[model samples]
Target chain A: MESRNLFMRMLMHAVIIIMVLIWVVPTLGILISSIRPASDVLNTGWWTVFKSPLEVTQFTVENYESIIERAGMGTAFRNSVIIASVGTLLPVTTAAFAAFGFSRLNFWGKRFLFGIIIGLIVVPLQMTFIPVLRVYHQVGLSGTFLGVWLAHTAYGLPFAVFMLHNFFSALPRDLFEAAYIDGASLLSVFFRIALPLSVPALASLIIFQFLWVWNDLLVSLIYLGGTRDVAPLTVRLASLVGSYGQDWHLLTAAAFISIVVPVVVFIGLQKYFVRGILAGSVKS
Target chain B: MAGVTLENVTKRFGDVVAVKEATLEVPDQDFLVLVGPSGCGKTTTLRMVAGLEDITEGKIKIGEKVVNDLPPKDRDIAMVFQNYALYPHMNVFNNMGFGLKLRKIPRDEITKRVKEAAKLLGIENLLDRKPAQLSGGQRQRVALGRAIVRNPQVFLMDEPLSNLDAKLRVQMRAELSKLHDRLKTTIIYVTHDQTEAMTMGDKIVVQNEGVIQQVAPPLTLYNEPENMFVAGFIGSPAMNFIKVKLRREDEDFFVDGADLNLKLSSALLDKRPGIKEYANQDVIMGIRPEDLGDAQVEKEFQVSDDNSFTADVEVVEPLGSEISLYFKIGDISGIARVDADSKARVGDKIKLACNTEKIHLFDRETEEAIK
Candidate 1:
């Protein structure tokens, strides 16, 4: 029995290690290839670095400096930060209020309204682009920050409301009723009690939205118009790949540059990300 | 600080009625308990008064103003829920002072009132701790302190101590009574536990199936229940109901069952003017367990054949101070709370006496008492 238990534990560890390597290996390859010179990257695989452990001379910062200076990666990086921050904030704020109403309050057409919102998740974003772009043009918001924020918020809301509604509805009903009787209005209860207790859910949604918007090329390209000033990191990176497809070292460095903000965000919000997922599954 | 009156209040959800035309008056500083078994609408009635639930039909008044359309906040009420719904994000002081702060009270006053309520609940040192850090008993006290700090017109408690263990529930029960006396605020409490109802309520409302069965002081409710439901619901062992036919045998009334016959005194019949009308008709004879004891060990009442009978004991439960003897009286099972000294054992035949003056007879059809 003891030997069988040891075998089972070892098998579980092996499975987990395999899964982690599957995700981490590609990211590690990008990181290693980003620092290598253009000739070295084209000639050898990323794993060849172990053949000469002390080959410090093989590494170069020229690819990073050239990407930032010539490809205008710095401005793209700032634009990505602004767009993602606004996009994440807009959807999360609106979704929290909508989720509170959907879960806690009762009114006519409540079920019908929630059913419609949830049903909208099935609508493809590609299908709405032409019509949404026309509306944005008529309103003179196209190629602007407000237009991108609005677009991202609309794309993010349905799923955000769906996830947050699950968390908010699972909270004890007695707490809301007690607050009401304790002299709190509906909005006050939403702000003071619901919002505070829901930090984990909000943080996770922020991470999800911020990462999605930061990495998006298609939405930002269509809505923000791929211009030098308005283009985000994803658009610039995609354009770099299109214009200079042969520059493997610069492409790797640019790809790594675009991922930096998302990595920092995931790490910063990682504590809440795990807890929020578990909280939805467990009874408090 | 003021009374609450509900007039012809009814609540319906979709097609099912939860509370039906419930009328009640809770006077100032009174502890009124609404108690019944589960799904009896006791909690619904309390919620309706608190303005947490919509009253489907009638008007509810806090003090003198009708609050039918008012939200819970405008109704000047505080509710302590069964699970002690303290804000998980806030510490004890903040939880207690949340209501006062919402009312726009000054920071110093909120602090003072919170400290005062914590001191009153003997949780002064725990004011800084969040609800998740407290024990179940302490959480319950914080829930109570939240209500106490509000100083609302009324307090609505929905089984606040039901989450505690039996020992803690008893301790909290006494502490709640003391809290009520000190606060002098009108409180409407709901629970399914009869002991809490009997010990803490100034007036008890016994409800079943969304209708109020009887509302009276504690002892009056226990002794003079209006119907068979109240009689059976109020007591611990529950009142034994025996279906018997009332027959007139030479001017003396006798209750006759399949295998048992017992006589009723003429004086007892004279006192109950409606007893003659039940002659030759089937009636439910309700006898409490304490009213039935070993005839051989009796002291006060007359143990004649009119109220004494022999039954074979089926089970004996010794409770130290007293023994509960379960026996079959004719076709129906009955229990007798007798002195522990009685030498009664299972399957032994023993004579039991009923307190004739304390007997309750209910109509077979309506189940109402035949006064």
Candidate 2:
């Protein structure tokens, strides 16, 4: 039994190691290739550089510098930050209030309203893009940061409300009753008790919304019209691989930049995401 | 500090009635307990009084003011839930002072009241600790302190000790009685444990199936249960029920049953003339375990007949001061509480005497006491 257990453990470890290599190898290759000179990258694979570390002639910071100064990546980076921040803030705030109402408050047609919200979860984003663009054009909101923010917020709300509603519902009913008996009004209870205790859920939602908005290219293009001034990093990166599809260096640099914020957000809020997911899944 | 009255209060959830039309008066400074089995609506009644539950069809008055529509906070009542619903996010001091703070009491006054309540509950040193940091008993005390600091018109407790271990439950039960005495506040307590009800309540209300069975002092309830349910519910080990028929021998009445024939005492006969109408009719004879003991067969108090038969002991449980003998007479099994030192063994045939005066006679059809 002991030997069989040890064999099983070894098999599991081997499988995990292979899976990790599959995921990490390409990312590692990209990092090495991004720093190496364009000639070295074209001459040999990233692995060849490892054979002669003292050569020093293989490396260069020119790709990063050129991507920023010549390729207009700085403006794109700034636009991504503003869009992601506003997008995250807008969805999370509306979702929190909507979730609390759906979970706690009772009014006419509450179940039907919540059912409509849940149904929206299955509606494809592509199907709504034209209609939304038309509405934005009529309202004079197209090709603007505000229009992009609204579009992202609308697209993000269904799942956000679903995630947060389950968390809000799982909270002990006694806590709300205690607050009520303590003479806390509905708004006070929501602000002081509900919101404070919901940090894990809120953190996870913020991370999710931020990453989705930051990586998105389609919605930003449709609503913001790919204007250089308002275009986010994703649209700018798409433009890097031009209509002719050349310039891999600029494309890779922009892709890395776009990936940076999401990675940071994920690493920072990973614990809360795990906890929030479990909290929503479990009954209590 | 104030009286609470529920006038024909009823609650329903869709098609099911949770609490029937129930009227109760909790007098000023009285400790009243509502005791029954689970789903008996005791907690619902208490919640209705606290204004946590809305009355479906009647009036609720607190201190002579109609409070049926008032919310729990405006009802001036504090409740300690069975789970000790202390705020998990707050320290003990903040949890206790929360109501006062909501009422906009001065900060120093809230602190003073919180400290006093903590002192009274003997949890002064633990005020800085969160509820999660406290033990079960300490959390229960914090829940009580939260109620205490409010200084409300009434205190409603819903089985606050039911979550504790057996030893802690006993200790907390006594402490709660003492607390009530010291505070002299009108309190409505709910529990399914009859022992807690009997020991702590100045007046106990026994309920079952959403109906109030009996409401009286514990001793009165024990001595004169209005029905078979009350008789069996209020006593430990429960009242032993024997299916019997009332028969008259000459002028004296006797209860005849399987393996037993007993004469009804004159005291019971005079008080219960209704038994005369039940002669030769099926009736239930309820004898508490403690009322049966060993006796000389020839004693004048012994009412003998050919129906008296021997029974073999099935088990004997010694409870330090008393031994409970479980025996079977034919197919009918019963328990008898005897002296602890009695030499009784399993499978031994020991004749036990029944106290005729203490036996309760109930109409078999209605399951109500014959009075």
Candidate 3:
């Protein structure tokens, strides 16, 4: 039985190794391609650079420098950060309050209101683009950073309210009652009891909303009108690829540059992701 | 500091009635317990008093003012829930001091009160630790300390010790009794455990369904139950009930029940003059387990044959100082608590003496005491 268990463990390890290699190989290729000299990248496979052990000439920072200086990649990076922060923060705060009210407070038409929000989830954002764009145009928000932030918050709210509501409602009713008896008003209970206990759920939502907003090109392109000043990393990268489709080295460097923030955010907050997803499943 | 009076308070959730017109007067400095089986609405009554649930049909006065329109915070009461309900994010000091801080009490005063409460609960060393880091008993202390630091007009506890292990529950039970003495505040406690209700409460309100059953001191409740339900609910192993008939043969009166006959003591008849109305009709007879003993062991009770009956002992549970004997007489089953020195064994026939004075009679239809 012990030997059979050992055999099962070894088979599981082998499968995991194969899965990791499948995921890491392409990412390693892009990273190696991003730093190589343009001629070396085009003339030979990215694998050939690894064959030369420590040849100093095989690597250069010119691709990253060119992307930053000539392509206005730095501005794009700053724009992505601003959009993601505002986009993630506004929806999470509003949704948390909405979720608390939906979960804990009693009001007339609560179920119907919540049902309307859930119904919104099934309607694709593409269906609202024309209407939302018309509204933005009338309000003079069509080509502004605030327009994209508002768009992201509107798009992000339904799922955020739905997810955080489940977490907040699943909390023990006794905690809120104890707080109320401890002389807390409804708002204090939301800020002190409900929000503190919802850190795991909030962290997962932040990662999810931040990554989505950071990587989005379509919404920003339509709402921000593809302006050079307001275009995010995603829009900038798309424009770079349009002009330099065959410039693999610069494209790889710009792609890597665009992905850096999301990778860091995901890695830093990865622990909360597992816990938050499991929050509704486990009892406590 | 203040008494709570509920006048015909009722709570209805949609179509179901959770508490039906519960009216109780919890005097200042009284530890009144509301106890019943699960789903008996004891917790519902407590919640209504705390203003967590709206009183659908009555007035609740915490002191001089009617508090039906007040929210829980404005009602000036503190509650300890069954689950303890300590804030998971806050350490012990903050958890205990949260209510004071919410009331806008000064920083150092909140500190002093929290420290004093922590010392009272022996949780001073644990003040820096979050609730998640504490054991179950420690969390219970923190919950109690939270209520204590508030020093509200009344304290409400809902089965606070039910979450602890049996030993810890007993320890906390005594500590809570002492805390009540020191604080001298009105407390409305709710528990389903009758032992807790009997031990900790100055007065216990027994409930069944949504209706209050009996309200009296614990010993009075034990010795003089108002109905069959209270008799069965108050004691461990419960009071054994048997169908019996009362007959008057010439000048003497006798009660006849399954393979047994007993001459009624004149003293009993004198105390319950109304028992004459139940003569020659079926009535329920209740006898506590401790009221029956081995006829051979209890010679001092003067076990005359008229007051004794034979039964086949089916089970003997020796509990060191005393033994519980399960026996059957004809078609009726009964239990006797006898001295451990008794030689009765399972499958043996033994004569059991009945303390005729201790037997209770209830109306078959109304289930009320004959007296």
Candidate 4:
């Protein structure tokens, strides 16, 4: 029985290792290719680096410099940061209040309103673009960073409310009631008690919204337009592949560059990320 | 610190009424407990008093001010919830001081009050620890400290010690009584536990199905329950109820049940002379476990046939100090708390004597006591 159990465990671990390698190996290849010179990348595959692993001359900073200094990657990166930050902040702030209201407050149309939000989660974003863009144009926001932030906020609000609502609702009701009796106004309770206890949920939500907006291609392309001034990392990368389809080295460099912020965000927020899967709540 | 008066307070949730026209007056500094089994609206009534729940109809006055329109924050109350409800992220110091801080009290004053409360609860050393780091009893203390720091006009506790172990609950029960004595604040406590009500309440209000069954001082409520529900609910090993026909044999009053007949003592008749009116009809006799004893090991009461009945013992529960002898006096199962030395065992017929002086008689239909 011990031998059979050991064999089964080994088999399961082998499957897991293979799955991790499948995801990690390609990312590792892209990282290596991004540093290799355009001439060397054109000459041989990224795996050939093992032949002369100690040859530092094979690596170059030229691809990165070319992508940033020459190909407008710097502005695109900056634009992505601004858009994603504002987008994440706008939605999360609105969603937290909406979630608390939906979960904790009583109003005449509460059930109907929450039901509508649940229904809206299934509505496709692509279907709302044209009408939203019309309003965007009328407000002269058709091709701006603010336009993309607004669009992403609208796109993200439904799920954000749904996720935070479940988390907020799971928080014991006694805490809120206790706060009320302790002489805290509703706003005070929301800010001091509810929000503080909900750190993990909010942090994970920030990571989700930030990452989604950072990597989003469709919304930025449609709402902000593909201009050099307003284009994000994603749109720029797509354009790099479109206009310079043969520049594999630069595309590889751009790919690695685009992922840097999201990777840092995930790692920075990773501790809070999984802890909120079950709301670690007050005792009550 | 002031009294709270609720006049005709009724709470309704849609169509279902949770509290029905409950009227109560809690004088200043009294520990009033609302207790009943689950779903009996005890917690609902306490919440209504705290202004955490709205009164659907009626006036609730804190002192002389009608507070039906006041929010909980404006009602000058503090509540300790069953699970403590300590802010999980805050340390003990911050948890206790959070409400005062919100009230915009000076920093030093808040700290001073928090420290004093911590010292009072004997948790000064634990002030730096978060609620997650504290033991269940310690968390309960922190919850109490939080309420104490508020020093509100009224303290509302909803089964605050129900989460603790049995031993800790007893210890906390005593500590809470001491806290109440020291703080001198009106407290409206809610629990389903009868022991806590009996041990801590200055006045106990027994509720059943959203209606107040009886409200009186602990011993009075226990000894003279207004109805059968209160009589059954107030005691542990609750009062045994036997349906009996009250017979008037000249001046002597007798309660006759299946295989059981007991002449009502003159002392009970003097307190409740109305029992004579129900002489030819059926009534229910309520007796506590301790009120019945082994006739063979008798003490003060005489072992005459009028107050003694023979039955085969069905079970014997030895509780160290005393033994609970279980038997059937007909279809009705009865328990007698007899001295541990009584020689009663399962299957042996034992003659149990009822304490006629302490017998309670109630109407058969309404279940109300004969006053």
Query: Per-residue alpha-carbon lDDT of model 4 for B1-371, expressed as tens digits?
Result: 99999899999999999999999999999999999999999999988888888889989999999999998889888899998999988899999998998889999999999999999999999999999999999999999999989889998899998989999999999999999999999999999999999999999999999999988999999899999999999998989999999999999999998788899999889989999999879999999999999999978678898888998899999999899999897788988899888999999988998899899999989999998
What are the runs in model 4 whose C-alpha is more than 4 Å off?
A1-12, A279-284
State the local distance difference test value for candidate 2: 0.86
TM-score of 2: 0.92
**Candidate 4 lDDT by residue in tens digits, A23-57:** 88999899899999988888999999989899998
Taking the tens digit of each residue's C-alpha lDDT, what string does model 2 give over B60-127?
A: 89898999888888888898999887878889999999889889999999999999999999999999
Give every collision pair in model 2: none
> Could you tell me which residue pairs clash in candidate 4?
none
Error of 4 at A204 (Å): 2.0
Single out the weakest 10-residue window by summed lDDT for candidate 4 chain B: B298-307
Better of 2 and 3 by lDDT: 3
Supply DockQ values for each candidate.
Answer: 0.80, 0.60, 0.90, 0.82
Q: The CA-based lDDT of model 3 is what? A: 0.91
lDDT of 3 at A104: 91
Candidate 2 docking quality: incorrect, acceptable, medium or high: medium
**Chain B TM-score, one value per candidate, order as shown:** 0.97, 0.95, 0.97, 0.99
Top-DockQ structure, candidate number: 3
Each candidate's TM vs. the true structure? 0.95, 0.92, 0.96, 0.97
Error (Å) of candidate 3 at residue A237 is: 1.8
